[model samples]
Target: MRTLSGDLIAHRLSQAPAGALSKRLYDVLQTAIQQGAIATGSRLPASRDLAQELCVSRNTVLAAYEQLQSEGYLQTRTGSGTYVCEQLPETAPQASLSPSTSSAPFNHIRLSRRGTRVLARSGAGAYQWGAFMPGVPDVSHMPHDIWRKIQLRLSRRMPVEALSYSNHGGCLQLQQALAEYLRVSRSLNCAPEQILITAGTHQALDLVAKMLCDPGEGAWIEEPGYWGFRNVLAVNGVELLPTPVDDEGMLLPDLASFSQLQRPPVLICVTPSHQYPLGSVMSLQRRQQLLALAKSAGSWVIEDDYDGEFRFGESPVPALQGLSADAPVIYLGTFSKTLYPGLRLSYMVMPKPLAARMKMAHSELYRGGNGLAQLTLAEFIREGHYAAHVRRMRQLYSRRRAALVKVISDSLGPAFLSQQGNAGLHLILSLPERIDDVALAAELEQKGVLTRPLSAYYIQGTQRRGLLLGYACVEEQNMAETFAPVLHCLQRRLSPA
Candidate 1:
């Protein structure tokens, strides 16, 4: 066995004579580390030094080192030398000498729970009305045939590189298409380099959470807001402050001046175009104020434009990121709401400087979503299918929303208060006083009408009792029939007679 420079010795493969010993060395080192022979925190030799000691080519040493790294046996710290990862398990013998275990009561390390996350219960697979669904598009009438043709054509003409991870920033064609689409449609003033394609809004949120907010820094969230946003912030260990939201979205004046507060938020997340749960779009006047405040405070404003593509009436409001002069805002838009949520395609528009860092983080995070899907979507957006599709769905959803509104008015009466946010898939039907929304929803579920309660979206005091009803998926003809029973259930629960 040839001893390597620092601490490694080659484990001899007596049976096999090998010319390229790097592959064998890599496997041996990996097995040693995994089996705990080479303990965690142990350092390996420099590639050049190890090569000389082992009497092998520098390439062989380099190859072996890289293989160990890719397999997670060793981790490279920026500027610091490669060390055996703390992620690597230690041998039982090493544990015997540990002061904590040897001197104190013995207990096994729970790898399943410790150093790992237990995913919080999400509303996945559960059919609940009005929960902030991560990915559900008004796919009631998307032109699948057209999309399929585009995908087929793209696949045929696509370079072999398209089959592999093309670029960390995402597909170039898609980025170009998105940039052009945003400029005219969204009024976003940015180029393709500013966009970092991501796997839906969840990944976008997670990336922003990782990038801007340090642990314990405040990330101001809306009270009674979309739970997923709060969940992302919460799991990241951000100090969350729930600001109140009322008739207008995000109650700008209520944003507790971070300067006045000791722990000022480094980041602020808001669904400005259309507030989730309550479904109130932040007014144009307040949009300016939010930008001014975020600029003044020098905090990054994360505008999650989830359902911004759908505006059934009036001129489309300008994106807050577009309106803002300070380049601190990170704009997030996803096809989950605009197209099919199952597509799992979304993008983040970054300020120039942040884009470079975001790209570095992205490659480390996920080399980007599937290259094939990105290619398909690129053609969809490039050929004008995306915009045309949204226009059709917007009209379709408008009819369903109107139908839901009518059914609520007639069956539940005008006495039950409601939120008046137009241009989203769902709306909140505020209930009368003294009715338990959660309990009522359960009763409604048994009647085969699944509706969401506003109480569940709340994390603070003074939560309103109501149901969140999504109209996008329901057919305009069936909207009345589908909502009739739900409305009756809410009415019967609140009746005084």
Candidate 2:
């Protein structure tokens, strides 16, 4: 809060390399004003005081002040001191605000081809939490007290080493805990050394794409797949071949049909547990077929089991990575859906051979940290809290899902067909062929009922006209109230015009 003085300012200005006195003074004042060292509306020292302090002639200081005023870096008040201008002048150079350009504006700078594609396919919504907002877990039901107790205990007693950078993969405790958990729960065959912890599944996919596939390499993605996967692969310059999904999961083309591709895919990403948005569990036969195909083609399968722990009634489908001993499957899982998104913890179980390379790359690319959280989570899993919480959420989500389904049936009737999927946090409500899912979703969103358009998930081919309604975050008691707007929107839209 100390006020800047004439002597101090003049001394600092004197440090500049030898140059014209007036020009140097002008440049220093201009820089100070631009960088906010001289705050806007701040009264500068009088020209006489600054001149005396710097031992410069009064005329030299006056000339510098006048030049600054002309450049709009200062505002002069007759009988008062000059003040830093609140705003830059119209003619002022915009070098700091924009990239260097002689005749064009910043907007003229072209985006990379991948950037353009990503922008065109951008599906990120501003709103995240609301009725039917897809992929969001009910954080309200989280065991905050238990989690806080663990966090507090760890914070107070954690070793100094736990506060520093973690191993290239992750904290050994967390990795071991995750490996065991995956082994028992998801049937993933992984050791602690094979696991590479990531910020989230998005980062996990990015690493896989970067390490396994090169730019422009053929990569197969499910047609109606997770947009995050699509965008990440696209940004990495992967030539994405949109493989269609069927009732059992991603449909693998016969070897004969596969041979027609200009280049075979080096990697294939699948949401095998509960195929995202659509919620179809990949059948064991299809899982075997995919593993075999990937093996035959010498490709890698990225198995993303994002919400596999939330199955309502059916027995949990074990991850595809566990099917074969040497299956080239990179198993990916995240705590975002299981716990909370803000925790930002996910992991990938890499094949042992690739583990060392991925670890090196992961460390170089994303230096691992967040040891405290990882340790806390490791304890959470080891102590059985994570499984217990998943079990509780599974029941809660089931009731909420049932409530939503009932509301849709009672309000919209048979016109809207809800896909029967007992796993995952969301369900796809297929609409009548004539109704536009996007328009309906927009109307619903305006009315406070959030839903994702099914067509947006498709990269190409005939897109299904449906709405993905997530029920995990909505309580059973509020289901009717939350869905009321959806009913009204549908009634207005589906009514004869």
Q: How do all models score by TM-score? A: 0.73, 0.80
Task: Give all candidates' CA lDDT scores.
Answer: 0.74, 0.84
lDDT of 2 by residue, 1-497 (tens): 22365754675576655678887777667666665667888898888878877788999889988988877788888888788888877666532221121336457678888889988988888798877899999988889899889989998888776787665588888989998998999888889999999999899889888988889898888888888889999899888889888779999977767667667799998988888878888898898888878887888998888998988877888889898889999998899998999999999898899998898888889888898899899999999999999999889999998888888888777546545678788888887777788888988887777899888888785468888988988889998998777777767778899
lDDT accuracy of residue 137 in candidate 1: 52
Backbone clash pairs for candidate 1 read none
Tens-digit lDDT track of model 1 for 162-250: 77764558888889999999988888978899999998788888888887888878887888787778767777778778888876678
Off by over 4 Å in 1: 1-121, 128-135, 253-258
Worst 10 residues of 2 by lDDT: 94-103
Q: Where does candidate 2 clash, by residue pair?
A: none
The numbered model that scores best in lDDT is: 2
